[model samples]
Target chain A: MSIIKAVHLRKRFIVKKKEPGLKGALKGIFAPKKIIINALDDVSFSMKKGEIIGLIGPNGAGKSTTIKILTGILQPLSGEVEVMGLNPQKKRAEVVSRIGVVFGQRSQLYWDIRLGESFELFRRIYRIPDEEYNANLELMDSLLGIRRLIDIPVRQLSLGQRMRGEIVSAVLHSPDILFLDEPTIGLDIQAKRNIRKFIREINQKKKTTIILTTHDLGDVQELCPRLVVINKGKIIEDGALDAIVHRLAPERILQIDTDKVKKDFTYPHCKMIKCEENKMWISFNRENVSASKLIAALSAEVRINDLQVKEPDIEDAIEQIYGEG
Target chain B: MRCAVQSWFEYPLEMLCWIIFIPLYSFGGLLLLKVISTQFSEIGGWTFHGLAFFYGLGIVTHGLHVIFFFAVWHTNYMVLNGEFDRILLYPMNPFFMFIIQSFNIAGYIDITPGIIIFTYACLKLNLDWNAVAILKLIAVLIGGTLIRTGIFMIAGAIGFFRDTRNAVTNFMVDFLAYNTTAFPLNIYPYGIQVILTFLIPVGFINTYPAQDFMGMDNTFSIPINLSLCTLLVGIAFFLLAYGFFRFGLKHYKSTGS
Candidate 1:
């Protein structure tokens, strides 16, 4: 059964148009002009229980608006939203208990207290019993390697370490659905990899439906199978990540490292993106010239030291969808 | 609940700072009282010891709000920072978690001193701390604090709908302080007094309790009775605020900044 469903969901905000200066500030108090903001428009989607879907979008692309509506934190102006067969707005307290959410760039874990303190607060708040609490703590420690960082105050942990703690904190209640928004915003490569492993492991073992919204395409590549793309208050695309990637760009970039120091290297079929000496990156349409053909063309001019072919990654695909610079 | 309080007092330096800060405030308040007490024998014939009870009552509750609800002051900041979203995902009441999470133990500094002053005033007057008097003190102190916090919760809930909590919150504090600490409601004309007792209930903070201590007539406590009625009305207001907050949550657009 689909655990989350939304149809034609819409929302708008009236923000006061503020003007600068003393006179403007005074005038604003009396006569304020409001700008109509259509944050969400005619959106529709659904998620089955235990499915991990990645929601990707650019800045001001209505990613948060959708998440808020689904989680019952927000009410749609005109639309329908149902989570677990109940209207979220009407049953926020009931729906909220079943869903876990994490907003990145903000630490929910207490800043002064140790990570364990925040964990205990959750345990008592959720009315979690002793046995389940200890078992979950042990499980999280094993899964996220959080045993070392337990006693350390949140102010001390690195961004990556804090995020690992955030994920475990979200799932401590054993919620059926986990919503993580930009969970790896500012993390090192190793930290990102560690989080990716957890996201996968949690999904596989618990069948916990996950909705991940992230700027990091690498996260989507490694973890999410389904993709939901939003742009300018509308759903631009939603499907398999492969479909979006292939649909956007279907060409491979070939870089050929030549042994000879050749300055001028140009070809009609394949344009040299960079031709400084022997190392040159060649770009060709996949339909026009295959990787083998490009290799043959390169071997004719200079001895090929090393050859690497790279397909358009999810980053390029997403950028193309958004037309972002 | 005890665990929450334990976590709150985890900062020792903070506790010490509050302890010192309260005495500083008390000195200032005492100076004000000493100077003002000379000019004004009473607000409606109430004495220095009588006014001290009112002053101590306000500070004690203020202490409670400061220690327990320092974070409540930042309801807008928390929402803007996307901190409330953290509490929402939990399998518990977000409001309850936030109240507990934002607690500071330093309130006892001012509160303890205020109680001591109140005790001194009672002893100076040679008033009874007998069973009935003790019960009245507890009722006035605890109930008064709860009412103070409940009003703040209502105000804090307002921030969930609005993006910024500007002078509106300050306005509440200023307006309430003026009405409660400055004078008694009976001194004012009938219409103004009714507005205070019925509409806003600021009079409950001091005037009615002072009357109870002086053994004044029951009219002083009309405001207190109305405030007590908040047991039903306050929840309704809170639910309205909660509904409004949940509605506002849909439009919550977290800035990348």
Candidate 2:
């Protein structure tokens, strides 16, 4: 079942046209010019219950605008948004209650207060039940080890620790849908892994529907099963992660190390990508020729000592998708 | 409010500076008034004590405004910085949370001098300590605060229309509203009085109440009972301000990235 849906969503921003220099500043004061910018142009997408979907796009491509509209922080110029069976604009409070959002660049916690105090304030704000709140806290503690950092002031905590606390607070109320915008924007590898693990555990234990927007392709590759690629305020592509990769980069690379060197060889549906001495790299479309087939064909020609297969990296695939879009 | 208090204790020196600086600043204003009164024993047909009484009323109301409406004062900054987005995400009326979060503890510091000065002026004036007078004073103070905050809310509502660094709202609250409360309204021309009393209603915050307390001839054509005028106009202005805020919120174009 679709937990969130948006139809023909559109938003425009009126930006003042400031001219350069002192003369322009004076002219601007007298006769300010305004240009209308289409922040979101007929964007449309939907997410199923408990599905993790990545909303990927280039900067200024309306990814954050779309997220703001869905979260009800922004009202689109024209559109219909339904989150958890309620119109987000018309029933904002109700819609917000069912969702949690975290902006990685900004924190919602009080900077001077302890992390636990912030959680308690949120608990009162959300009116979460004591038992459920405690259970969720325990779950967060186990998943992110947040209890150890709870006593420290928010400002004193490291970026990674603060982000963990942010994630924990966002979910303390057991929101059914979580909107994570660049949740791992500045985290180190270890922090990123911990956050990814936390995200997976929450989705598994609570069936939380998550909509993640980030430039980090690793996040999309590791977490999102589905992808909604947007560019220029429009949905460019929407499908499975592997399908996107397959559609963008269909060929897989196979590296072979042989005991004996051989002449440059090619077979039907297989091309020699590179050859250096006893080692050769071959590329072949998986649909036309399986890895086994290509390997057997290469093995017959060269005395194979070692073999390795490399699937296309998601980074390259996403870059291709973005570049094409 | 609790969060603000907790944060206050986090830096003892800054908090102490904040608490001390408010009354110290007000003391400078007091010194200015003294210099003025020393030269001319009376201004606007009222004695020095009478004018000081009005000043006290204005200070207390200003402090109350700060306490209750700090969020409205900061709406422009919040909107500009995109902090207002978080308020919308909470599962409650954003205005309610804004007001609750804005109950600044340091605002009480501003009230200390106002209370002390007002009490001293009243004692000097030898006003009858009747129950009715005391009750009326309480009503006037509450109403004055409402008027002050209503003006603030009206100014803050402008944030919804544009991204501002607070030049407009500051002009409205700090210069127009706050300055008008500092002295007798009768000294100003009739047109200015109308603007202060009917338009921004800064005169209602203190001047009208002072006139009634001193039993002086009110400048306005309409006769006003102190308590009734304050209660009626205070509630009316506050509702209008809140209504304006809600109307402005419909046009809230958040600083979307």
Question: lDDT for every model?
Answer: 0.74, 0.86
Computed on C-alphas against the true complex, the DockQ of each candidate is 0.35, 0.71
Judge the docking of candidate 2 as incorrect, acceptable, medium or high: medium
lDDT of 1 at A319: 75
How many residue pairs collide in each prediction? 1, 0
lDDT tens per residue, model 2, B1-257: 68878987899898789888889988778777788988987788878888888888889888887877777788777778788778888999988988887578778888889988888889889899799988888888889888888887888788888766787768757887667877789989999998888887788788988888988877875576965688678889999999998878767777655
Model 2: what TM-score for its first chain?
Answer: 0.89
Give the alpha carbon lDDT tens digit for every residue of B66-158 in model 1. Answer: 777666667767776766666665555666667776576666676777777677677666776688766666666555565566555556656
> Which candidate has the top score in lDDT?
2
- Candidate 2's residue-wise lDDT over A1-325, tens digit each? 6899999999998999999999999998899999988989898888889999998888888888898899988888998888988988789999888899998888899999999999999999999999999999998888999999999999999999999999998999999999998899989999999999988888988999999999888898899999998888888889998888898898889988987766668788888878787788888888899888777877888889999999987777877877876
Q: Please name the candidate that would achieve the greatest TM-score relative to the true structure.
A: 2
